[model samples]
Target: MPTVDFTLRWPDGRQQRCTSPSTVIHEHFVDGQEMPVPELVARMRVAMHAASERVRARYGFACTGAAEQLEQIEAVAARYGGDAGPVTVVAVGKPAVPEVPRAS
Candidate 1:
């Protein structure tokens, strides 16, 4: 199964490395739909939260104030060696300036 790796930095400058199976990563896009980097990051946050919840449920242990301590979450890497693979989604950026047609 594919996995999404990320790091979460706490308010105290502590960092926690976490990974979640791609199955838990939500479908943030539809057919031909696009999003921005910030939105993508938001989706990642949701996935991380879900992963944390799973851990809490299965292992019955979780970091205190984990939810509130989330200073930043960054997607580090992804592995797709098995049945799961990368997710294809368009991350839109600022619109390009229109080119002025020069006189011949």
Candidate 2:
């Protein structure tokens, strides 16, 4: 399984480093994009669940890091109530490695 570590700039301009046990995050987000807090949290929910499922499928147990990441996102989002603004996607520490083609 591939692991991904991403950085997000919170509403208060503080950057947080987050991790996922799977590469599902690339499907949900990208670097240099800004998303509303609610949207970001929502995406995290979906992505983390998928990531956990991946971990469960491969290792027979869900990934604790996924749960922790979601909690961090939720906590940051909590600081901003209704109409919480956007958060910037700073960087991805590791991206999905492209598959190498096999010779036929």
Candidate 3:
């Protein structure tokens, strides 16, 4: 298990810090990619509903984290614990993908 600290800047010159039970945060290189942690947090309701369907489809268990996903992730992280290092940091301003050349 790994924990990542997400620093978010607010519009009114405020900053917020939150720790997430995520191994890594990957920015979208390809189109239509989903960043699960952000998505889960932003759209907890929908994501939880989908997650319920996900569990049901997988092990025939109908469990959704409509309001408990965050706590669950945190609890799991605590149970397994995590290493402090081995975390890769990507700059927010970096390019998502490499440029390609056309063949003549």
Candidate 4:
């Protein structure tokens, strides 16, 4: 499984660095795109769940880190009122690739 980091710029001008245990995050976010708070929360919810499910399928266990990240995102999002502006997707970090051993 690949791990990816995504940066978000909140409407308040604060930047949040988030992580996922799976690359499913790419399907949910695009760099430099502005997303509404509620839409972001909903998209992240689905992405995190999908990411955790991928980890569980491969490692036999769900990814706690992804869940934690989602919790933090939701908490921050809740701080912004319904009338708040959209959040920007600052950047999406490249996925980390594991080294593979070549046959000798």
Best by TM-score: 4
Judging by lDDT against the true structure, name the best candidate. Answer: 4
Ranking of models by TM-score: 4, 2, 1, 3
Candidate 1 residue pairs in clash (backbone atoms < 3 Å):
none
TM-score of 3: 0.30
lDDT of 3 by residue, 1-104 (tens): 23334443322323334333222232211222323333323443444455455556666766533235545433433332133221111222222243578899
* Local error of candidate 1 at residue 22 (angstroms): 6.8
* Candidate 3 wrong stretches, greater than 4 Å: 27-104
**Cα deviation in Å at residue 20, candidate 1?**
1.5
CA lDDT for candidate 4:
0.92
- Model 3's lDDT to the true fold? 0.36
User: Each candidate's TM vs. the true structure?
Assistant: 0.37, 0.84, 0.30, 0.90
lDDT of candidate 1 over 68-103, digit per residue (tens): 333333432121222232333422222234468999
| Model 1: lDDT to the true structure | 0.42
What is the full ranking by lDDT, best candidate first? 4, 2, 1, 3
Kindly report which residue stretches of model 1 are placed more than 4 angstroms away from their true locations once superposed. 1-22, 26-34, 63-104
What local lDDT does model 3 show for residue 41? 39
